[model samples]
Target: MSEPGGVSTGGAIGLVAGLLALIGGPAAFGKAGAWLADRADRRRQSRADGNREWEAKLKAWEAELDERAAASLRQCEEQCAELRAVVEKMRFAMVLILPEVERFAPSSPLLQKASSLLAEILPVAIKPAPAPPERPESISA
Candidate 1:
């Protein structure tokens, strides 16, 4: 005999199979989640390693910069000392020459001639003023 409303037992079995598949789908989803977590962990470790390497490089660069700066400062100080010595020598020579020039030139013509000779020979750059006394007011008192 046929079924009562013509629906068969095979349709019921198919519906039960579909329901089972729906219930088991979450297990597959859990595997995908675990794989993603492992990948993220590996990426985190890589980033940490990169950061450490960069930090070491930065420290080394800073040390090199400091060394170069110290060397440059030493060179500048040596140059400055040499320049000071040259200036002192120029001052001593000018002192000796200026007295002789004044002694020889009591008149305007001799003075002009001496000045012209000095300009031609020495080419003096700067004229330093004489230093004032340490305590001028006390000396006057």
Candidate 2:
């Protein structure tokens, strides 16, 4: 039905809708702004928690890698130590026995082979391996 003064029903409904928007727009906008602010605050804390988890994982991975590297390095050092001890012993034994072999069997080919090998290898094993070069920073400028 139409209202008085020729106001159509559609016009009255449109007028009410416009009036409601005018009154309610700012309130709705403020409520939405509050909701978004709260959401952002919540997400910020969650992001921090996520980052803490990632940091802990990185620390654990680094520790594991360091442990593996240390284990391999220790193994290498043990092998080198065994090699040095064996070389020192063999050099002593060769020195003690080579002369006896030469005196007993002057023409033995074993003496020649032993002598050549000792000449090549003994000098290296006789001296302690040179100390590693000093760090570059240690030298006086």
Candidate 3:
């Protein structure tokens, strides 16, 4: 007999039995569960391997870029040194010309301008790289 507002005991038993069969009891469900777990593990391992490969590539690229940047800086410094050398030579020529102008034209504006221009700009002298010490000739006994 059914309760006033709840399932009958017989109906409840039938419903539980149906759910157990639909879910394949224990053995069948266990195999499916194990397969799902294995698939998840494989996927996790694959992702870790992919991450390692990507990280390795990034590190290699970073090293190459650093090397290129260092090489470029050296080239730029060399160019700058050559330019400085040229400027020093030009300054020397200007100094030599100044005395001649003063002797020829005592009231020349060109001499005054040249003197002021040299005085206004700060001269930066670049020191040459020191030569390596010469090894004394070894006396063969």
TM-score of each: 0.53, 0.62, 0.63
lDDT of 1 by residue, 1-98 (tens): 33687766787666655665677766745765687798999999999999999999999999999999999999999999999999779866765666
**TM-score quality measure for candidate 3:** 0.63
**Is candidate 1 or 3 superior in lDDT?**
3
Give the candidate number with the greatest lDDT.
2
List candidate 1 segments past 4 Å from native: 1-31, 107-141
CA lDDT of every candidate: 0.72, 0.78, 0.77
Candidate 2's TM-score reads 0.62
- Candidate 2 residue pairs in backbone clash: none
Top model by TM-score, which number? 3
lDDT of 3 by residue, 10-116 (tens): 99878866675687887656766688899999999999999999999999999999999999999999999999999989988776666666665656787777677
Which ten-residue region of model 2 has the weakest summed lDDT? 124-133
* Native-referenced Cα lDDT, model 2: 0.78
Summed backbone clashes in each candidate are 0, 0, 0
Give lDDT tens digits, candidate 2, residues 6-120. Answer: 8989998778666656877767557656888999999998999999999999999999999999999999999999999998998889877776667666667877777778878
| TM-score pick, better of 1 and 2 | 2
